[model samples]
Target: MARMPLAERRRQLTEAAIRAMTRDGVSRTTTRSIAAEAGVSLSVFHYCFDSKQALLESVLTMITDHYIAVVKEAIRPRATLRETVRAGFQAYWDHVAARPAEHMLTYDLTQYALREPGFEHLARRQYELYCETYAQLLEQLGRQTGFELLVPVPVLARYLAAMTDGVTLNFLVLGDADAAAGILDMVTDHVAGLIRER
Candidate 1:
């Protein structure tokens, strides 16, 4: 057997944790289960993460990073701000549709983190990352389109994050793609309406 590089090993453990949480729910998932899922020993799991809470934090970061990449790739400069914003929203909902399991796991972990003592910071940091990432994206879009948002970039970013969370959660619970698409279109239109051409 060969030793995995440090980064690779960490990624493996994180992925395993995601699977365990998705399969067993966050409350039931354990470090031992995650290690088993990763095909690593308990000692290796301990070496990688001090506690399950630490591992959940890493999972939150990984999930957020993935979402940021997806949105960034989906959105691009377009002829009009409306087109750009609509395209971005469409791309995002498409991603949620494709990976419902991952999204569900994220929501589950969020609840888990919020209820657990000393772990609430992970939930706070997760939303902060979302807000920060969206703020940067909104700034870039404004630069590209010469449009100004009705609200400050940070406020709009937080609003968009909250909107996305609501839409995704609704879709997850309802399992209605058509309804989700309609809601997404409505939300995108409202968001696009917020930007004035400068």
Candidate 2:
């Protein structure tokens, strides 16, 4: 393989680990498997990441980033804040529908992290990352639309994070697109109500 920067290689390996874990599960996926999935050798994998914990952290971050990027792109200000938020949720739903396995893998990763010794922090960090992502999105929306949230940024962010996690889990378990859309609509209205227009 051609030479690459350490950061790039680590990202490549992390993505590979995601795919491998999604396919074979976190418990089953080994460093050898991740290396093979990334088309790198075992030594290369170790060079990039010292342990599987690091890889798991990278994978969780990567997963969170995938949907957050979509939501950010879709969250541009529309005619109304409600419409803009709806667009963002729609974008997220579209992503989940298209990549169900990847989303499912996130929950699996969470369970695995929680059960694994000394890895509980990873699961905690995962939720923290979710809330942080939501906070940034809320901040971005505020900037774009010049609206104030009745709730503090941190509180609203955690609320959004919890609601989203529940909705995603509900959709994954039930596979009811219509119900999911309704839940999204209810959430959109609730979230919009929290905003104070400038």
Q: Using TM-score as the measure, which candidate wins?
A: 2
Total backbone collisions, model 2: 0
All candidates: TM-score: 0.94, 0.97
Query: Measured by C-alpha RMSD in angstroms, how accurate is candidate 2?
Result: 0.9
Error of 1 at 57 (Å): 1.1
Off by over 4 Å in 2: none
After superposition of all CA atoms, the RMSD between model 1 and the true structure is 1.4
lDDT of 1 by residue, 89-108 (tens): 88788789988999999888
Query: What Cα-based lDDT does every candidate model obtain?
Result: 0.86, 0.93
Candidate 2 per-residue lDDT, tens place, 34-138, comes to: 999999999999998988999999999888898999999999989888999999999999999999989999999899999999999999999999999999999
Model 2: pairs clashing at backbone N, Cα or C within 3 Å: none
